[model samples]
Target: MFPAFAKYRQSFLIGLQSNLVYRMNFAVRGFFSLFHLAVVFILWGAVYSQNESIGGFSFGQTLTYFLVMLVMQFFVGAFNEDYQISEEIRSGLINQFILKPINYFSYRFSIFLAARLVTGALILIPLLVAVPLLKDYLTLPTEAWRFFLLAPAMMLSALIQFSIAYCFGMLTFWFLEIQGFVILSMAIESLLGGQMFPLDLLPAWIFNAAKFLPFYYQTYFPTAIITGRIEFAAAIQGFGIQLIWVLVLLAVNQLLWTRGLRRHTAVGG
Candidate 1:
């Protein structure tokens, strides 16, 4: 167990180093992230200009939700593991992994985790600095416990997102050209994952329907908890739903990987 753990640690270090070498990319992404957040603030500010609240969200609460949503997105978003995996399969690079003792999932996931760690930190610096400037627009949870509860929910959210990406990546085994599928999936996720807006702000029927999907768990549910939109008991129940989604997605990922391995072939040297 120790040796295997060490192997993953090494994989993570390699990933971290590889990503750190491209510091400019992180800077560019951080810039764009801040720009996007500003756009959200302006858009929502306009919406709340006339009203004190909408859908039970005050102006500050809505902005706070977007703030947390942006940070959550930085932590879990922009992963291209699906595209990377598809490319590996298409280029026959996956054959190299078959020759190694490492678990492909663990190795790839370690790399994914490592990249997120570096990027998340890079994004965090500006986010912290922006907090004081944006304090009036931000509405934090009054209950300290809600902040504590957010940790696990965010963890589960990351896992769910990873599993979704991994499953999509595995589709390369069957569909050699999956760029369209990847784009479509990302668009759907962005819309449904509450990256565009808080899910609760949607029509009641739409919000209820979204609960049946995993995308909401990725961004909305966790942000809602941190912003106090989700109370203690509901947050607890939401966490249970998140855990269940993780398990379900993990099973789906495993099934896809096993079946994909059977169909996968190294076409190029």
Candidate 2:
């Protein structure tokens, strides 16, 4: 197990080091994410200027909500899905990966996590430094224990998202390409998963329907916990929901991977 982990460790370190080498491009990506923050602030500010509160969210709370959402997005954003996974599957590069004793899922996931950490830290450092200065007006969570609990929750959220995404990307084994599928999935996640706006702000029926779907567990509930929008009981319920969805999807991925491997017929292999 150690040897297998060592291989993945090496891959993750390589990805981390490579991200550092291209730090300028990463900085630019961070800047682009800030545009989303700006747009949300402007759009929501207009709406709030007319109304004191909408859907139980006060003006200040809504602003803080968007800020937390934006920051969470930057922290958790993964890279282009199809290019990373589909390319390997189509080009038979994945077969090379199979030859190694290392687990393919672990290798891919570790490298991706490493890269995300490197890039996310580049953006988060400034936010951390400036957050204290803005604490007077901004209402961030004051509970240190909640912040501590958030670390593992964040990791679990990222892992669950990546597993589901990579499983879909693995469909390139049969689909031949998955760019269109990737776009559709992202669109659904944004609209149905509360990535664009608070789920509570949506229509009651729509929000109820979204609760049954795995999308809510992606960004909404976790961010809610971080923002103190959810109390202890509610947070536990949310975590349970997330855990169940992760297990279900993980099972699906296992089934898909097994089927894919059986069907895979590359020339060399």
Model 2, residue 49: displacement in angstroms? 1.0
Scored against the true structure, residue 200 in model 1 reaches a CA lDDT of 80
What is the lDDT of every predicted structure here?
0.84, 0.75
Which lDDT value does model 1 have at 72?
A: 87
Tens-digit lDDT track for model 2 on 151-187? 7667767777777678877898789878888888889
Q: Best candidate, TM-score-wise?
A: 1
Model 1: per-residue Cα lDDT at residue 11: 94
Residue range 1-269, candidate 1, lDDT tens digits: 99999999999999999989876788678778778878987898898998888988798888888888888887876467788877877888878888889888888889889888888888887787678889877768678888788788888888888888888889888887888888898898988888887788788898878877899898888888888877788778787888899999999989998899898766665
For all candidates, the clash counts are 0, 0
